[model samples]
Target: MTAINLAKDGLWKNNPALVQLLGLCPLLATSNSFATSLGLGLTTLAVLTLSNFTISLVRGLLDEETRLPVQILVIATFVTLADLSLQYWFFDMHQRIGLFVALIVTNCTLLGRAEAFASKNPIISSTFDGLMMGTGFLLVLLLMGTIREVAGNGTLFTNLHLLTGTPDMSIQLADSGFLLLALPPGAFLTLGCLIACKNVIDGALR
Candidate 1:
């Protein structure tokens, strides 16, 4: 694919969260706050990029029969590295999102890219695909987290110290906020609205 088309696919047309709807578990569970979303998003991004590049390098040795298990082994290796690195450098953030980090190995988004794109393409293209796809996923997480935090908590980036380790970094907008938006039902509602808005925009453009 052309670079522009690849970018469009990742950012809009075939987004992992909105279009493909892969990886919604962590997308909803940890997206209640901006910091958590950003943290997990970056972690996923790193894993995807590395896994895709590595898979592309070894694609020749992989056949249809061995592809699935080999892909998971490659992805799991990177996920473990990401998990350990986070714990060492960003212990607090690790503590908060560690479970989700471990879960990235099971995330179809990563494995799908490895099997569908990385295994069929050159290293450079696979790496770019991983980056773009990861960025799309990150954008959705950030948007959902922002909406939920702003509407539910009347703040943005609350408890951000968990990620940045800086004091007084959160922006407080109001004393009180809607409680429902902070819960699971609220995530579903926010995601539904987002999908609707995306569809409306796409339809208008078309």
Candidate 2:
């Protein structure tokens, strides 16, 4: 595939968020903060990629009737490892992100790839697809989380310390804050604006 198409597939056409629209439950839930959203997004990405690789390896030997069950087992295994890895290294962030981290097992993103792409494609292609799809979801989460945090709290990155180990790494936007920006409604508004922005960029390129 061409680089341009690869980008389009990952960022637009086959996007886990905008196109496939998978994993909306966690996407809408933990996006309250940039840190929380980013943490969960990366965790999901790792699980998806690993599971896709595993499924691609077993594709030839697996029967069609049992393919989905086998795929889920593989995905669940990776998700467990991912959860433990995150809990060990990013305990605080894990705590902040909460149940959304564990929900990666149920994320349609991984299962969709295993069923739709990996079962047919070569391992290399399947792995690349996972990376791209995972990245698209991460991009959406970060975009929405950043906007909400910035607008609602008057800080672009309120707790950069958690990410950078620096204390009070925040830039104030204004003295007064827009309370609504931190709420659930703000998430929807920010996501809409983000999708609109992506569409505009896509149009320009086209």
Candidate 3:
């Protein structure tokens, strides 16, 4: 597929979070707040892109049996780097979602892309695909986090300083917000609404 098609598929047509639902564990867990969501999203993006590029570069050397293991090793290496970097640079943020960072190795989105796209494609195409797919996942996390934060906390960007190293950037929207949205049940409800909206939009476009 062309670059444009790849971008479209990753960002919308086949979003890892929204459509493929590949990494919902981290997506839902870290999406309670915007700062946590962005932190995990960016880390996942970096790991995904780098792992794809690395896997594509070495795809020719691997036989069918060892491919999955090698791809996973590449992904794990990147995830470790990301986790350590976050711990060193953004200790507070890392403390919030560091486990999730490590769990990126198990995220199906990374492995699926490595197996389905990167292994079969050229380096440039594979890298771009990873970047786009990661961005799509990040956007979905951001949206989910934004909705949950606003509805549950009555604020946006609460605890954002953990990621930005700046003063608190939260903007309070109300005196109080819905308590349910701050809980696990809220994640499911919000995701359901988002999927429904995407389907409606797609249907309209068609």
Candidate 4:
């Protein structure tokens, strides 16, 4: 596929979070705030890109029977490194999302890309695919996080210092917001609305 089509596919047509719905665990569990979602998004992006590139590098030598196990190992390695980096540098944010961070190993999105695209494509194309897919996932996380934070916490980017170590970036709109939106049910509601909106947009575009 051409670069443009590949990008469109990963970002919208085959979005991991919005359309394919591969990583909803983290999406729903850790997306209560923008900071948490952004941290997880970046971590996923880094791991996804590295895993795809690495897997593409070794695809030629692996047998069919060992491919899945080898891909898991590759993805796990990057996830571990990402987890460690967050724990060491962004310790506060790490504390908040550490569980979900570890859960990235089980996220079918990474495995799906590794098996479906990276294992069969050139290194460059695989890398691009990973980047686009990760970006798409990140965008969805940001959207959900933004909605939850604003509706639930009455803040858009509260506690952003946990990720950037900058105090002035936080915003507060109200003393107490709709607390329910910060919970699991809110995640589902927001996501469903997002999916519906996407479908509507798709229909309009068509």
The numbered model that scores best in lDDT is 3
Per TM-score, the best of the predicted structures is 3
Q: How are the candidates ranked when ordered by lDDT, highest leading?
A: 3, 4, 1, 2
Estimate, for each residue in 29-92, the C-alpha lDDT of model 3 and write its tens digit. Answer: 8899999999999999999999999999999999999999999999999999998899899999
Worst 10 residues of 1 by lDDT: 159-168
What local lDDT does model 2 show for residue 39?
Answer: 80
Candidate 1 lDDT at 26 equals 91
Candidate 3 lDDT (Cα, whole model)? Answer: 0.94
Model 2 misplacement above 4 A: 1-4, 163-168, 200-206
lDDT-wise, the better of 2 and 4 is 4
Question: Candidate 1 residues 1-206, lDDT tens each?
Answer: 88888889988999999989998889988889999999999999999999999999999988889999999999999999999999998998888898899999988999999988999999988999999999999999999999999999999987778777779689999987898998999988988899999999999999
Better of 1 and 3 by lDDT: 3
Model 1: CA > 4 A from native: none
TM-score-wise, the better of 1 and 3 is 3
Candidate 4 lDDT over 1-206, as tens digits, reads 78898899889999999899998999899889998899999999989999999999999999999999999999999999999999889998888899999999998999999999999999999999999999999999999999999999998777688888877588888887899999899999999999999999999999
Candidate 3 residue spans exceeding 4 A from truth: none
lDDT of 4: 0.93
Estimated TM-score for each candidate: 0.97, 0.89, 0.98, 0.98
lDDT (0 to 1) per candidate: 0.92, 0.79, 0.94, 0.93
Give stretches of model 4 more than 4 Å off: none
Candidate 1: RMSD to truth: 1.0
